[model samples]
Target: MQIRPCADAFYASELEPWSEYISGQQGKDPGYDVLGWMIEETHKRGMEFHAWMNPYRISNSATAFATSGAANHPAKLHPEWTMKYDNLLIYRPALPEVKQHLLNVVDDLISKYDVDGIHFDDYFYPYPKGGVEIDDAADYAKYGAGYSNVGDFRRAQVDEVIEKIHNLLVAKKPGIVFSISPYGVWRNKASDPVAGSDSNSLQNYDDLYADVRKWCQNGWIDLVVPQLYASTSNVNMNFTKMCTWWNANSFEAKLAIGHALYRFGVPAEGAPYQTLDQLSDQFRISRSNKNTCGSFLFNATCFNENKINILSRLAQVYADKALIPVIGKESEAAPAKAGDIAVEGRTIAWKEQPGMRYAVYTVKPSSVEGKWDAKLTAVLAEPSWLAPGAGNYAVSVLNRDNAESELSQPVKVD
Candidate 1:
């Protein structure tokens, strides 16, 4: 699950320090903290929570609606680090101060919250404007000594942020995953001989100034969720072809498809995701591919509206519990086994590692063996869990990289 923590000069934070970014619901006597509730609820459902942040975007419009609170926004405070183009305010990535500010914000999210990972989508350069060029000429003049091409310079600047953030995140929170969801196509075959995908779509490398392929090859991020937000059957922007290209290019990071659930049944200029069958085939393609780790749907609210009965169809794919994949090379040695499982009524308790999560599994007496084929019954951050009902339960320690330790002795439930 991706929670938009910082967006459009406002945030979903309750910390008094984040008052600069209001949720617009502050007048309810108490400020609403969306991040807190999201984490708790997502965990309760045994899902990993990824906090998605738009690094540069400030105000969507420069006209300045009173609802935006642009006057006291952090961008206003650090006007030197911001650029305005096409009615949008973007933080200039060339500045060291801008990187530091983003570092601080993300560090706060990782250190303070219990997020499993931090996600950044492909909004690095604010999707280029046709008539207006980014106002980073001054920045380029000041900091563009070593680089000749301003485009390459901008790409380098974004690279610095990703590299520095990855370093800092690993240092501060060793196991926290850092990921980037850049635009789907890195480059067309016409652009690069090695680029695999065949498309005329806006390339992230050329247009957005994001070298997503380099980030993957450099092993800067733990995962990459490419926004393959197009119909699977669309010839030029074929979803399965894009998935194949990305999976082939996944150097050291896992690849997850950014599914377009919101686009289902929605009309588009050329092609439309007008049927649920397109999505079903897309899921089938992803499942068949060894490189495709998972899917991250675009918007969470799509299911709430029951649009075309999407929630029901998707539920069939998500019925079974799935664990977050651990980066094998990044994981630490499995923790010591969970000690002495004890159950009273429906509650179960056991010894645990300080920062590790525990996975509870239930196996039928007929199926019990050294190898447990059953999926996890529950995963809890705390040492204890309230089992859903009576069953033969066993516990295992999940390490920082989400690697599971050996299971503890099973304790029968009454």
Candidate 2:
């Protein structure tokens, strides 16, 4: 689960200070403090939590600039690091100082928080404007060389930032995962076969200077969640075709598809709202690919809307039962033993602690050797269960974020 802290005053003022304080309190509010709270909560429920962050976004709108407090204000302190193309302001990714500052922010988060992973979404550089170029002349004059054009310079800047973040995170905390969610299209096939998506409008590689393929091939991220927001029948960009393309192109890291549920029933003057079948078809394609690990919905609010019974369909198909998402192989920890277990009618309860996500398992008796095969039966959000059934069962709890515990002792169910 990815938790988005409200981008309002309450969070911005506390981000840096909270980072410092989280290192001391590990268990009390494991899933709510800074970024650690979310991870801790996910662990409690036997689910992995990825720390989703925006690298360059400072503020939503410049209008809030005046009212923002002094300590939490990003634009006021670093005016040179910002660019105003038309009216929209964006962080300047072409500066070395900019890269260093962003990396420091990420390091701070990782060092202080017990997180499972670090994630970046589709905003590397700002969306492009017609004739106006990003104001990076001062930066280029200072650092640009050998590179023929400003495009390469911008690409190099983004690459350097991502490379540094990846290395530092793995070195400091090898248990945490790193992932990126780039725009659906890399480049049009007309530009280069291996360059980008089939869409004609914009490319992340050429326009935004985000070389997602290079990052994947170089092992800079543990997973790639490309936002394939189009439908299979769309003339410009087909969702199904793009999923197959991404699966083929992904280097070694896991590939997860990003679904745009926000646009489920949104209609324009001529184009009709997308039907439920169109959305379901995309998931069907993703499930078929072995390389495709899983799928992530765009925003939590949109999913909560339950548009056209979309959420119901998704729950019925993808999440009929709770699941323990695949963790990074390198971060796997030894399973822990199950301690005391008690049953009260249908409700089973146990002691709860920090850094533990509980999974209940069942074992059957057999004549063959190694007959004790354990299958995951339930993931408990709390340290209790009211499951309906009578059977022999054993409960094991694993640290979902760190995967650092042994399987618990078996408890029988009558």
How much does candidate 2 score in TM-score? 0.82
> In TM-score terms, which candidate is top?
1
What range of 10 consecutive residues in model 2 has the weakest lDDT sum?
4-13
- Those runs of model 1 whose alpha carbons end farther than 4 Å from true positions after fitting are 1-22, 25-47, 65-70, 267-272, 328-333, 343-349, 365-372, 382-391, 409-414
List the pairs of residues colliding in candidate 1.
none
Model-by-model lDDT, in order? 0.76, 0.69
List TM-score per model, in order: 0.86, 0.82
What tens digits encode model 1's per-residue C-alpha lDDT throughout 1-414? 434433332233332134333434321222566567778798766567777788887656655623544344566656777778888877888999888888877776777688878888888887877888888889989999999889899999999999988888778876778888888889988888766478768888888889989989998998998998877767767888898898899888998999978877566623456667777888999888898889988787787776778877788888877778885245466778999678888888997678678888886554655655555777888899887777778888877677878878778778
Error of 2 at 23 (Å): 24
Deviation (Å) of 78 in candidate 2: 2.5
